[model samples]
Target: MRNLKYYFAIFSIFIMISCGENAEKKVEEKSKEETQIETEAKVSEKNVILFFGNSLTAGMGLEASEAFPVLIQNRLDSLNYNYEVVNAGLSGETTASGKNRINWVLNQDVDVFVLELGANDGLRGIPIAETRKNLQDIISTVKEKNPNTKIVLAGMQIPPNMGEEYTTDFRNIFPELAEENNVELIPFLLEGVAGDPELNQQDGIHPTAEGYEIVADNVWSVLEDVVEKE
Candidate 1:
């Protein structure tokens, strides 16, 4: 009977060890799952603000960090806002090009979309009707992708050298589109910097770093309200 007791005790000890090992494994798995959840939550918490546009927005002839979108990122950081700014501006990108690739850009979630395209179209004297249609399509696609996304139209105007009537029509496109689409509009992306030679680079087209600061202010004026609404 003593021998029998010893065997039973050994069996009991084995069962207890097996149970302890399983519990430890379960604990490790739970920890790993919790860590994954936390990582995903952090990623989801950051709102994406996409600055989609042309050379001016691309900060041509200047450092990328000096771009208005990067300036906006710095401002957001200073304000402690949970947002990530993506400067998707391509040099010499026209409205047509913007429309063609907008779908790929929309692949990611966008909380705020700042539209700065069409300047090249105006400079190249592309038909206003075509530019308008492209802009409309771009906005429509963005809404279709993420209806909750807020759009901010950055108004741009071509030089009067483009011609009086064409310039007027181009300038009107922004506010008209904003009114129709019910989106926010920045009156002119280069409000305080456009005509000032000091604010412009050698090409007198793109803004200098000092000029982008004012551009940042122009965008921030409208963007702050949209961000605060959330």
Candidate 2:
């Protein structure tokens, strides 16, 4: 009877050891999976980027996929990010028009704002002071809605034909606005593609597909910082 009891004790101890080892293995696997999921989520950019601008932003002359906003979307996708870019661009919209669109244009999911208005204002030769004020109001409204939202101010420069003084004033609007709003600014929205006639479409104002690629590069350079993957 004593011998039999000893054997039973040994068998029970062995079973307990096996059960503990299995439990430990399961816990380790679950931990590893959790870490992988977290890493992947961080690597994929899932933030919403709302682009508000004029004809250039609306892809006025280019196809749907040829627009800068669309190109940005493609680039983000290639990086395995989960994000959405809204082209809230109205052709020929001045700074005032952008102000009116602000309150309603903000979506709940907006994590970043790319302000590209004022180009039409420059074209129309509107007062720079009013343009600055209008842009300021839009940024303020957005900040009020989402204090943490990252902003990219898309700058514009009128042609020298607009008059040197006027062109300089128009160009300065972006930096001044950015300083006041405390946001990132792209030196030029059209950068390399604006004056290049070959890259422009028939209107010579809006960019063609090739031109939009350059525009996308300009925006992406500054926006790449706050832009994160899901």
Candidate 3:
């Protein structure tokens, strides 16, 4: 009877030890799961900067890495800014197409929206009023989707092939919209790079890799202020 009692006591201790270990293991698992959830939330919390535009934004005739938007991303990362850049640039996107597609792109939360459309419209000699309306509509949609979204318009100018009157009106559209909508404006997206053969690709429109560096600078000038404010 004494031997049986001693064995029973030992069995109880063993069961207790096993249960304690199991409880500790479950606690450790829960801690790990909580840590994973927090890490995922941090990643998802990163702000998004969407570049919406045409081939210039798309880096036409150049590698995607060579595009100005990616260069901007590199700069942001180097500066330790926690922003993700979404290059929504389609090669042939005009203001009308951009207006049509703005809703789809707005499905994701956008912290900063850099508008780069209307260049194609300018080049195509699309009616200035029509381009202006399309651009305004796009801006309106963005504002409606999220009033908190900071907008930045990339001003562009085309050759006089479209006629000086039309070209001037097209150029005026950007600032007018910027003032009216109270959004940031990149005075000239290709400032130093435009009209320079050395900076242009063989097609004489898109920027070369080296040219894109300057273009990135132009964007960064305005974008830096907006980002810092944010």
Candidate 4:
């Protein structure tokens, strides 16, 4: 009886050891899988190009993927330019609102920043001085966050409903700001798309997908230069 009991104890100990070994092996396999997934995710990460603006940037009323920024991404990808474009565009957003939200949007590292705000302010007939100041502040904040970051300012214009003076002043804001800040400027975001019924949505303000393609081209003309230098 005593001999039988000894054999049983040894068998139980062997079973426990085998179970522990299997558990340890499983744990090691899980750790390796997690590490591999993390590495893959890191490998896929690319430097960010942030597009900050209004509805035009947001691609409102269309699939988010159809937006100009994403189109820019597609362009960059096709060119083999390594960049991750982030569109932080909000519909109906004004310069003041952009100033308020700029910091939050810049929380991550931005290789390039495309400023597209102030159009809504122009549409609302906001004071040009106030619009300019808000845009200035937003730029200042961006520079403060990343001095080496490249900036591209998008110019916008409104109809002459507010008279030639207001419309002209609104049109001049972008170039003036770009010159003053030494940032690259996109002359007119809408350019070929604006005033074209075929390219515009029913509102006659926002662009359709085709219009966004032109807008993307306008932005790319300047952005490409900046990217090459970087």
Model number with the top TM-score: 3
The C-alpha stretches of model 1 lying farther than 4 A from their native spots are: 1-44
Report the C-alpha lDDT of model 4 over 1-230, residue by residue, as the tens digit. Answer: 21343454455545555666657776566556555655655546577899999889999999998999999999988888778899999988999988988888988889899999988898889999999999999999999999999999999888898899999999999999999999999999999999999999998988998998998899999899988522
lDDT of 2: 0.83
**Cα lDDT for residue 20, candidate 1:** 66
Name the regions of candidate 3 deviating beyond 4 angstroms. Answer: 1-22
Best-to-worst ranking by lDDT:
3, 1, 4, 2
For 73-143, candidate 3 gives per-residue lDDT tens digits of: 99998998889999999999999999988999999889999999988898888999999999999999999
**lDDT of each residue in 1-230, candidate 1, tens digit only:** 21343454455555555666657776566556555655555544678899999998889999989999999999998898889899999998999999999999998889999999988999899999999999999999999999999999999988988789999999999999999999999999999998899999988888999999999999999999988422
TM-score of 2: 0.79
Clashing pairs in 2: 41-230, 44-229, 44-230, 45-228, 45-229, 45-230, 46-82, 46-230
Task: Please tell me which model should have the higher TM-score, number 2 or number 4.
Answer: 4
* Pairs of residues at least 3 apart in sequence or in different chains that clash in candidate 3: none
lDDT of 3 at 38: 53
